[model samples]
Target chain A: MLEELTIQQKIKYLQDTLYVISGKWKLLILMSMYGGTCRFRELQRSVEGITTRVLSKELKELEVNKLIERKIDNTYPVLITYQLTPYSFSLKPMVDEMITWGAQHRKELSKP
Target chain B: MLEELTIQQKIKYLQDTLYVISGKWKLLILMSMYGGTCRFRELQRSVEGITTRVLSKELKELEVNKLIERKIDNTYPVLITYQLTPYSFSLKPMVDEMITWGAQHRKELSKP
Candidate 1:
Protein backbone atom coordinates (compact mmCIF):
# COMPACT_ATOMS: atom_id res chain seq x y z
CA MET A 1 0.00 0.00 0.00
CA LEU A 2 1.21 3.52 -0.77
CA GLU A 3 1.99 5.68 2.23
CA GLU A 4 -0.09 8.80 2.74
CA LEU A 5 1.65 11.97 1.57
CA THR A 6 1.97 14.97 3.79
CA ILE A 7 -0.05 18.03 2.77
CA GLN A 8 3.15 19.77 1.69
CA GLN A 9 4.08 16.84 -0.52
CA LYS A 10 0.58 16.85 -2.00
CA ILE A 11 0.74 20.54 -2.89
CA LYS A 12 4.09 20.09 -4.59
CA TYR A 13 2.69 17.21 -6.58
CA LEU A 14 -0.26 19.25 -7.79
CA GLN A 15 2.13 21.98 -8.81
CA ASP A 16 4.04 19.45 -10.87
CA THR A 17 0.86 18.25 -12.62
CA LEU A 18 0.14 21.85 -13.43
CA TYR A 19 3.64 22.13 -14.80
CA VAL A 20 3.03 19.30 -17.28
CA ILE A 21 -0.30 20.71 -18.51
CA SER A 22 0.18 24.40 -17.83
CA GLY A 23 1.32 25.69 -21.22
CA LYS A 24 -1.06 27.91 -23.19
CA TRP A 25 -1.73 25.28 -25.84
CA LYS A 26 -1.40 22.04 -23.82
CA LEU A 27 -5.05 21.65 -22.86
CA LEU A 28 -6.14 22.73 -26.29
CA ILE A 29 -3.92 20.07 -27.74
CA LEU A 30 -5.50 17.49 -25.42
CA MET A 31 -9.00 18.59 -26.37
CA SER A 32 -8.20 18.39 -30.05
CA MET A 33 -6.98 14.84 -29.66
CA TYR A 34 -10.12 13.85 -27.75
CA GLY A 35 -11.88 12.34 -30.78
CA GLY A 36 -8.78 10.40 -31.85
CA THR A 37 -5.26 10.91 -33.10
CA CYS A 38 -4.40 13.52 -35.74
CA ARG A 39 -1.49 14.59 -37.91
CA PHE A 40 0.57 17.76 -37.42
CA ARG A 41 -1.39 19.96 -39.81
CA GLU A 42 -4.68 18.59 -38.54
CA LEU A 43 -3.78 19.49 -34.99
CA GLN A 44 -2.76 22.98 -36.05
CA ARG A 45 -6.09 23.46 -37.79
CA SER A 46 -7.97 22.02 -34.85
CA VAL A 47 -6.59 24.53 -32.38
CA GLU A 48 -6.82 27.54 -34.68
CA GLY A 49 -4.45 30.51 -34.40
CA ILE A 50 -1.65 28.67 -32.56
CA THR A 51 1.75 29.25 -34.11
CA THR A 52 3.60 26.15 -35.23
CA ARG A 53 6.47 26.84 -32.85
CA VAL A 54 4.20 26.99 -29.81
CA LEU A 55 2.29 23.92 -30.85
CA SER A 56 5.51 21.99 -31.43
CA LYS A 57 6.84 22.95 -28.03
CA GLU A 58 3.61 21.98 -26.26
CA LEU A 59 3.56 18.63 -28.03
CA LYS A 60 7.13 17.92 -26.98
CA GLU A 61 6.27 18.67 -23.34
CA LEU A 62 3.22 16.41 -23.45
CA GLU A 63 5.30 13.64 -25.00
CA VAL A 64 8.05 14.07 -22.41
CA ASN A 65 5.46 13.83 -19.64
CA LYS A 66 4.16 10.56 -21.17
CA LEU A 67 0.71 12.05 -21.53
CA ILE A 68 0.91 11.70 -25.31
CA GLU A 69 2.56 9.33 -27.73
CA ARG A 70 3.79 9.95 -31.24
CA LYS A 71 3.93 7.37 -34.00
CA ILE A 72 5.65 7.67 -37.34
CA ASP A 73 4.56 5.94 -40.53
CA ASN A 74 7.36 5.32 -43.00
CA THR A 75 5.86 6.30 -46.30
CA TYR A 76 7.12 8.36 -49.30
CA PRO A 77 7.55 11.44 -47.11
CA VAL A 78 6.84 9.81 -43.74
CA LEU A 79 3.80 10.72 -41.58
CA ILE A 80 3.62 11.35 -37.85
CA THR A 81 0.61 11.53 -35.56
CA TYR A 82 -0.13 12.12 -31.89
CA GLN A 83 -2.52 10.46 -29.46
CA LEU A 84 -3.18 10.41 -25.72
CA THR A 85 -1.73 7.58 -23.68
CA PRO A 86 -3.98 5.74 -21.23
CA TYR A 87 -2.71 7.87 -18.37
CA SER A 88 -3.58 10.99 -20.29
CA PHE A 89 -7.01 9.55 -21.08
CA SER A 90 -7.56 9.22 -17.34
CA LEU A 91 -7.53 13.02 -17.23
CA LYS A 92 -10.46 13.25 -19.64
CA PRO A 93 -13.12 13.64 -16.99
CA MET A 94 -11.14 16.29 -15.16
CA VAL A 95 -10.66 18.22 -18.36
CA ASP A 96 -14.32 17.85 -19.27
CA GLU A 97 -15.35 19.13 -15.84
CA MET A 98 -13.07 22.13 -16.36
CA ILE A 99 -14.74 22.77 -19.71
CA THR A 100 -18.18 22.55 -18.14
CA TRP A 101 -17.19 24.82 -15.28
CA GLY A 102 -15.70 27.27 -17.75
CA ALA A 103 -18.93 27.38 -19.73
CA GLN A 104 -21.04 27.92 -16.61
CA HIS A 105 -18.88 30.70 -15.22
CA ARG A 106 -18.10 32.61 -18.43
CA LYS A 107 -21.40 34.44 -18.56
CA GLU A 108 -21.37 35.24 -14.87
CA LEU A 109 -17.90 36.64 -15.20
CA SER A 110 -18.53 38.65 -18.37
CA LYS A 111 -20.90 41.09 -16.71
CA PRO A 112 -19.16 43.93 -14.87
CA MET B 1 -30.41 30.80 -23.87
CA LEU B 2 -26.63 30.98 -23.61
CA GLU B 3 -24.75 30.44 -26.81
CA GLU B 4 -21.79 28.10 -26.94
CA LEU B 5 -18.55 29.93 -26.37
CA THR B 6 -15.93 29.93 -29.08
CA ILE B 7 -12.80 27.90 -28.33
CA GLN B 8 -10.80 31.04 -27.72
CA GLN B 9 -13.41 32.27 -25.29
CA LYS B 10 -13.40 28.93 -23.51
CA ILE B 11 -9.62 28.96 -23.12
CA LYS B 12 -9.70 32.45 -21.76
CA TYR B 13 -12.36 31.44 -19.31
CA LEU B 14 -10.29 28.52 -17.98
CA GLN B 15 -7.28 30.78 -17.66
CA ASP B 16 -9.48 33.15 -15.71
CA THR B 17 -10.52 30.36 -13.35
CA LEU B 18 -6.89 29.50 -12.83
CA TYR B 19 -6.15 33.10 -12.13
CA VAL B 20 -8.84 33.28 -9.49
CA ILE B 21 -7.83 30.04 -7.81
CA SER B 22 -4.07 30.12 -8.32
CA GLY B 23 -1.58 31.11 -5.61
CA LYS B 24 0.80 29.26 -3.35
CA TRP B 25 -1.44 28.50 -0.42
CA LYS B 26 -5.02 28.90 -1.70
CA LEU B 27 -5.81 25.18 -1.86
CA LEU B 28 -4.32 24.56 1.55
CA ILE B 29 -6.37 27.45 2.84
CA LEU B 30 -9.51 25.93 1.40
CA MET B 31 -8.64 22.49 2.75
CA SER B 32 -7.90 23.86 6.20
CA MET B 33 -11.23 25.63 6.31
CA TYR B 34 -12.91 22.50 4.99
CA GLY B 35 -14.51 21.42 8.24
CA GLY B 36 -15.91 24.81 9.26
CA THR B 37 -15.28 28.51 9.41
CA CYS B 38 -11.98 29.20 11.13
CA ARG B 39 -10.81 32.19 13.07
CA PHE B 40 -7.79 34.04 11.69
CA ARG B 41 -5.39 32.34 14.05
CA GLU B 42 -7.08 28.99 13.52
CA LEU B 43 -6.70 29.32 9.76
CA GLN B 44 -3.08 30.26 10.19
CA ARG B 45 -2.60 27.14 12.29
CA SER B 46 -4.52 24.91 9.90
CA VAL B 47 -2.30 25.54 6.92
CA GLU B 48 0.96 25.44 8.87
CA GLY B 49 4.25 27.18 7.91
CA ILE B 50 2.50 29.97 5.99
CA THR B 51 3.62 33.44 6.80
CA THR B 52 1.07 35.99 8.00
CA ARG B 53 1.61 38.11 4.90
CA VAL B 54 0.98 35.25 2.49
CA LEU B 55 -2.09 34.10 4.41
CA SER B 56 -3.54 37.61 4.38
CA LYS B 57 -2.96 37.93 0.65
CA GLU B 58 -4.49 34.56 -0.18
CA LEU B 59 -7.53 35.16 2.04
CA LYS B 60 -8.13 38.52 0.40
CA GLU B 61 -7.93 36.93 -3.06
CA LEU B 62 -10.38 34.16 -2.11
CA GLU B 63 -12.83 36.74 -0.75
CA VAL B 64 -12.55 38.75 -3.96
CA ASN B 65 -13.37 35.70 -6.07
CA LYS B 66 -16.29 34.85 -3.76
CA LEU B 67 -14.73 31.46 -3.13
CA ILE B 68 -14.65 32.25 0.57
CA GLU B 69 -16.45 34.73 2.76
CA ARG B 70 -15.68 36.31 6.04
CA LYS B 71 -17.91 36.76 9.10
CA ILE B 72 -17.25 38.78 12.21
CA ASP B 73 -18.38 38.07 15.73
CA ASN B 74 -19.40 40.85 18.06
CA THR B 75 -17.41 40.54 21.22
CA TYR B 76 -14.97 42.52 23.32
CA PRO B 77 -12.37 41.91 20.68
CA VAL B 78 -13.75 41.52 17.15
CA LEU B 79 -13.11 38.12 15.63
CA ILE B 80 -13.22 37.26 11.92
CA THR B 81 -13.63 33.80 10.43
CA TYR B 82 -13.57 32.51 6.89
CA GLN B 83 -15.81 29.90 5.25
CA LEU B 84 -16.23 28.59 1.73
CA THR B 85 -19.04 30.05 -0.37
CA PRO B 86 -21.60 27.71 -1.93
CA TYR B 87 -20.00 28.24 -5.32
CA SER B 88 -16.70 27.22 -3.76
CA PHE B 89 -18.32 24.13 -2.24
CA SER B 90 -19.25 23.11 -5.77
CA LEU B 91 -15.53 22.81 -6.50
CA LYS B 92 -15.01 20.25 -3.74
CA PRO B 93 -15.16 17.29 -6.09
CA MET B 94 -12.67 18.84 -8.46
CA VAL B 95 -10.29 19.71 -5.65
CA ASP B 96 -10.54 16.26 -4.10
CA GLU B 97 -9.91 14.64 -7.45
CA MET B 98 -6.92 16.92 -7.92
CA ILE B 99 -5.63 15.83 -4.55
CA THR B 100 -6.02 12.18 -5.52
CA TRP B 101 -4.36 12.67 -8.87
CA GLY B 102 -1.51 14.52 -7.22
CA ALA B 103 -0.94 11.61 -4.89
CA GLN B 104 -0.94 9.04 -7.71
CA HIS B 105 1.52 11.02 -9.82
CA ARG B 106 3.86 12.00 -7.02
CA LYS B 107 5.04 8.45 -6.55
CA GLU B 108 5.74 7.98 -10.24
CA LEU B 109 7.67 11.21 -10.53
CA SER B 110 9.80 10.48 -7.46
CA LYS B 111 11.09 7.28 -9.03
CA PRO B 112 13.42 9.20 -11.28
Candidate 2:
Protein backbone atom coordinates (compact mmCIF):
# COMPACT_ATOMS: atom_id res chain seq x y z
CA MET A 1 0.00 0.00 0.00
CA LEU A 2 1.01 3.61 -0.55
CA GLU A 3 0.77 4.60 3.09
CA GLU A 4 3.88 2.69 4.14
CA LEU A 5 5.97 4.23 1.35
CA THR A 6 8.67 6.62 2.55
CA ILE A 7 8.27 10.27 1.72
CA GLN A 8 11.32 10.02 -0.49
CA GLN A 9 9.78 7.18 -2.51
CA LYS A 10 6.45 8.95 -2.77
CA ILE A 11 8.10 12.21 -3.79
CA LYS A 12 10.15 10.51 -6.49
CA TYR A 13 7.02 8.80 -7.81
CA LEU A 14 5.21 12.11 -7.76
CA GLN A 15 8.03 13.99 -9.43
CA ASP A 16 8.68 11.64 -12.31
CA THR A 17 5.07 11.27 -13.39
CA LEU A 18 4.25 14.91 -12.84
CA TYR A 19 7.44 15.86 -14.65
CA VAL A 20 6.22 13.90 -17.66
CA ILE A 21 2.62 15.13 -17.82
CA SER A 22 2.66 18.09 -15.44
CA GLY A 23 1.22 20.68 -17.76
CA LYS A 24 -2.16 20.94 -19.48
CA TRP A 25 -0.73 20.23 -22.90
CA LYS A 26 0.82 16.73 -22.65
CA LEU A 27 -2.39 14.79 -22.03
CA LEU A 28 -4.19 16.79 -24.69
CA ILE A 29 -1.43 15.96 -27.11
CA LEU A 30 -1.73 12.30 -26.11
CA MET A 31 -5.48 12.36 -26.75
CA SER A 32 -4.93 13.89 -30.15
CA MET A 33 -2.48 11.17 -31.10
CA TYR A 34 -4.50 8.32 -29.56
CA GLY A 35 -6.38 7.25 -32.64
CA GLY A 36 -3.63 7.26 -35.22
CA THR A 37 -0.57 9.07 -36.49
CA CYS A 38 -0.87 12.83 -36.78
CA ARG A 39 1.30 15.32 -38.59
CA PHE A 40 2.67 18.33 -36.75
CA ARG A 41 0.16 20.81 -38.05
CA GLU A 42 -2.71 18.37 -37.59
CA LEU A 43 -1.75 17.90 -33.96
CA GLN A 44 -1.46 21.64 -33.46
CA ARG A 45 -4.91 22.04 -34.90
CA SER A 46 -6.38 19.14 -32.95
CA VAL A 47 -5.40 20.23 -29.44
CA GLU A 48 -7.06 23.63 -29.89
CA GLY A 49 -5.37 26.81 -28.66
CA ILE A 50 -1.98 25.21 -28.00
CA THR A 51 0.84 27.27 -29.42
CA THR A 52 3.51 25.68 -31.57
CA ARG A 53 6.17 26.26 -28.90
CA VAL A 54 4.19 24.43 -26.22
CA LEU A 55 3.07 21.69 -28.55
CA SER A 56 6.60 21.14 -29.78
CA LYS A 57 7.89 20.95 -26.24
CA GLU A 58 5.20 18.47 -25.13
CA LEU A 59 5.80 16.33 -28.18
CA LYS A 60 9.50 16.14 -27.43
CA GLU A 61 8.84 15.16 -23.83
CA LEU A 62 6.39 12.46 -24.85
CA GLU A 63 8.87 11.16 -27.36
CA VAL A 64 11.65 11.08 -24.82
CA ASN A 65 9.42 9.19 -22.40
CA LYS A 66 8.65 6.70 -25.20
CA LEU A 67 4.94 7.38 -24.91
CA ILE A 68 4.95 8.52 -28.51
CA GLU A 69 7.00 8.10 -31.65
CA ARG A 70 7.85 10.79 -34.18
CA LYS A 71 8.49 9.74 -37.75
CA ILE A 72 9.44 11.59 -40.88
CA ASP A 73 7.48 10.91 -44.03
CA ASN A 74 8.79 12.13 -47.35
CA THR A 75 5.56 12.88 -49.12
CA TYR A 76 5.17 15.84 -51.49
CA PRO A 77 5.92 18.47 -48.89
CA VAL A 78 7.17 15.99 -46.24
CA LEU A 79 5.39 15.25 -43.02
CA ILE A 80 6.30 14.48 -39.43
CA THR A 81 3.90 11.97 -37.93
CA TYR A 82 3.35 11.41 -34.22
CA GLN A 83 1.79 8.21 -32.96
CA LEU A 84 1.39 6.42 -29.64
CA THR A 85 3.73 3.65 -28.68
CA PRO A 86 2.56 0.39 -27.09
CA TYR A 87 3.89 1.78 -23.86
CA SER A 88 1.58 4.72 -24.14
CA PHE A 89 -1.43 2.45 -24.44
CA SER A 90 -0.79 1.70 -20.82
CA LEU A 91 -2.55 5.00 -20.26
CA LYS A 92 -5.71 3.92 -22.00
CA PRO A 93 -7.48 2.69 -18.89
CA MET A 94 -6.63 5.81 -16.95
CA VAL A 95 -7.79 8.10 -19.71
CA ASP A 96 -10.97 6.13 -20.21
CA GLU A 97 -11.70 6.34 -16.50
CA MET A 98 -11.12 10.09 -16.67
CA ILE A 99 -13.53 10.45 -19.53
CA THR A 100 -16.18 8.62 -17.52
CA TRP A 101 -15.53 10.67 -14.38
CA GLY A 102 -15.41 13.89 -16.35
CA ALA A 103 -18.81 13.28 -17.87
CA GLN A 104 -20.24 12.62 -14.46
CA HIS A 105 -18.63 15.78 -13.11
CA ARG A 106 -20.21 17.86 -15.84
CA LYS A 107 -23.56 16.29 -15.06
CA GLU A 108 -23.15 17.12 -11.38
CA LEU A 109 -22.26 20.73 -12.17
CA SER A 110 -25.33 21.26 -14.31
CA LYS A 111 -27.77 20.23 -11.58
CA PRO A 112 -29.89 23.19 -10.51
CA MET B 1 -9.53 4.99 -28.95
CA LEU B 2 -8.89 8.35 -27.31
CA GLU B 3 -7.91 9.73 -30.68
CA GLU B 4 -11.47 9.56 -31.94
CA LEU B 5 -12.82 11.75 -29.14
CA THR B 6 -13.72 15.28 -30.19
CA ILE B 7 -11.82 18.18 -28.70
CA GLN B 8 -14.83 19.12 -26.63
CA GLN B 9 -15.03 15.61 -25.24
CA LYS B 10 -11.30 15.39 -24.72
CA ILE B 11 -11.15 18.72 -22.95
CA LYS B 12 -13.94 17.70 -20.61
CA TYR B 13 -12.17 14.44 -19.82
CA LEU B 14 -8.84 16.15 -19.28
CA GLN B 15 -10.33 18.86 -17.13
CA ASP B 16 -12.26 16.46 -14.92
CA THR B 17 -9.26 14.29 -14.04
CA LEU B 18 -6.89 17.19 -13.69
CA TYR B 19 -9.48 18.90 -11.56
CA VAL B 20 -9.35 15.93 -9.24
CA ILE B 21 -5.57 15.50 -8.95
CA SER B 22 -3.92 18.39 -10.71
CA GLY B 23 -1.40 19.41 -8.07
CA LYS B 24 1.52 17.65 -6.33
CA TRP B 25 -0.26 17.37 -3.00
CA LYS B 26 -3.51 15.65 -3.99
CA LEU B 27 -1.89 12.45 -5.20
CA LEU B 28 0.46 12.37 -2.25
CA ILE B 29 -2.49 12.81 0.05
CA LEU B 30 -4.21 9.97 -1.71
CA MET B 31 -1.07 7.86 -1.36
CA SER B 32 -0.86 8.57 2.32
CA MET B 33 -4.42 7.38 2.88
CA TYR B 34 -4.12 4.35 0.63
CA GLY B 35 -3.36 1.93 3.40
CA GLY B 36 -5.91 3.00 6.01
CA THR B 37 -7.39 5.88 7.94
CA CYS B 38 -5.10 8.78 8.89
CA ARG B 39 -5.50 11.78 11.13
CA PHE B 40 -5.13 15.37 9.86
CA ARG B 41 -1.71 15.85 11.43
CA GLU B 42 -0.55 12.44 10.21
CA LEU B 43 -1.27 13.36 6.59
CA GLN B 44 0.45 16.71 6.97
CA ARG B 45 3.48 15.03 8.46
CA SER B 46 3.51 12.27 5.85
CA VAL B 47 3.44 14.60 2.84
CA GLU B 48 6.27 16.83 4.11
CA GLY B 49 6.64 20.53 3.21
CA ILE B 50 2.88 21.08 2.78
CA THR B 51 1.29 23.83 4.82
CA THR B 52 -1.88 23.57 6.90
CA ARG B 53 -3.70 25.91 4.51
CA VAL B 54 -2.96 23.83 1.41
CA LEU B 55 -3.72 20.65 3.30
CA SER B 56 -7.20 21.85 4.26
CA LYS B 57 -7.94 22.97 0.70
CA GLU B 58 -6.82 19.66 -0.82
CA LEU B 59 -8.76 17.66 1.77
CA LYS B 60 -11.95 19.53 0.93
CA GLU B 61 -11.49 18.94 -2.79
CA LEU B 62 -10.86 15.23 -2.32
CA GLU B 63 -13.92 14.87 -0.11
CA VAL B 64 -16.08 16.70 -2.64
CA ASN B 65 -14.92 14.32 -5.34
CA LYS B 66 -15.85 11.35 -3.08
CA LEU B 67 -12.29 10.03 -3.33
CA ILE B 68 -11.90 10.23 0.42
CA GLU B 69 -14.14 10.07 3.46
CA ARG B 70 -13.78 12.30 6.50
CA LYS B 71 -14.98 11.39 9.94
CA ILE B 72 -14.65 13.25 13.18
CA ASP B 73 -13.67 11.45 16.37
CA ASN B 74 -14.48 13.27 19.59
CA THR B 75 -11.69 12.14 21.86
CA TYR B 76 -10.21 14.34 24.60
CA PRO B 77 -9.04 16.88 21.99
CA VAL B 78 -10.85 15.65 18.81
CA LEU B 79 -9.39 13.99 15.75
CA ILE B 80 -10.40 13.83 12.09
CA THR B 81 -9.62 10.65 10.19
CA TYR B 82 -9.24 10.54 6.42
CA GLN B 83 -9.72 7.35 4.50
CA LEU B 84 -9.86 6.44 0.83
CA THR B 85 -13.19 5.41 -0.65
CA PRO B 86 -13.65 2.55 -3.07
CA TYR B 87 -13.88 5.13 -5.82
CA SER B 88 -10.37 6.27 -5.07
CA PHE B 89 -8.95 2.82 -5.55
CA SER B 90 -9.82 3.28 -9.23
CA LEU B 91 -6.71 5.39 -9.28
CA LYS B 92 -4.57 2.58 -7.91
CA PRO B 93 -3.41 1.29 -11.27
CA MET B 94 -2.46 4.71 -12.54
CA VAL B 95 -0.54 5.54 -9.39
CA ASP B 96 1.20 2.19 -9.48
CA GLU B 97 2.16 2.79 -13.08
CA MET B 98 3.51 6.20 -12.18
CA ILE B 99 5.52 4.68 -9.35
CA THR B 100 6.98 2.13 -11.75
CA TRP B 101 7.73 4.73 -14.40
CA GLY B 102 9.17 7.08 -11.79
CA ALA B 103 11.59 4.44 -10.57
CA GLN B 104 12.72 3.80 -14.14
CA HIS B 105 13.13 7.52 -14.62
CA ARG B 106 15.30 7.79 -11.52
CA LYS B 107 17.41 4.90 -12.66
CA GLU B 108 17.85 6.51 -16.07
CA LEU B 109 18.85 9.78 -14.46
CA SER B 110 21.42 8.08 -12.27
CA LYS B 111 23.03 6.20 -15.18
CA PRO B 112 26.44 7.60 -16.09
Top model number, TM-score: 2
Query: What Cα-based lDDT does every candidate model obtain?
Result: 0.74, 0.79
> Model 1 over residues B11-78: C-alpha lDDT tens digits?
66666656665655777788778688788889888777898988999999888777899998897688
TM-score of every prediction relative to native: 0.67, 0.70
Instruction: Give me the runs in candidate 1 sitting further than 4 Å from their true place.
Output: A1-6, A104-112, B1-19, B22-29, B32-61, B70-83, B108-112
**Which residue runs of candidate 2 sit more than 4 Å off their true CA positions?**
A1-15, A71-81, A100-112, B1-11, B73-78, B97-112
DockQ of each: 0.26, 0.34
Encode model 1's per-residue lDDT on A1-112: one tens digit a residue: 1137665665666566566666557877887787798999999998878989988989998888778899999997998999988878767555555666656666655658
DockQ of 2: 0.34
lDDT of 2 by residue, B1-112 (tens): 5667777776777777777788788898887787699988899998879999999999999998888999988887787798998878867666666676676666654666
The Cα RMSD in angstroms, rounded to one decimal, for candidate 2 relative to the true structure is: 4.6
- Candidate 2 global CA lDDT score: 0.79
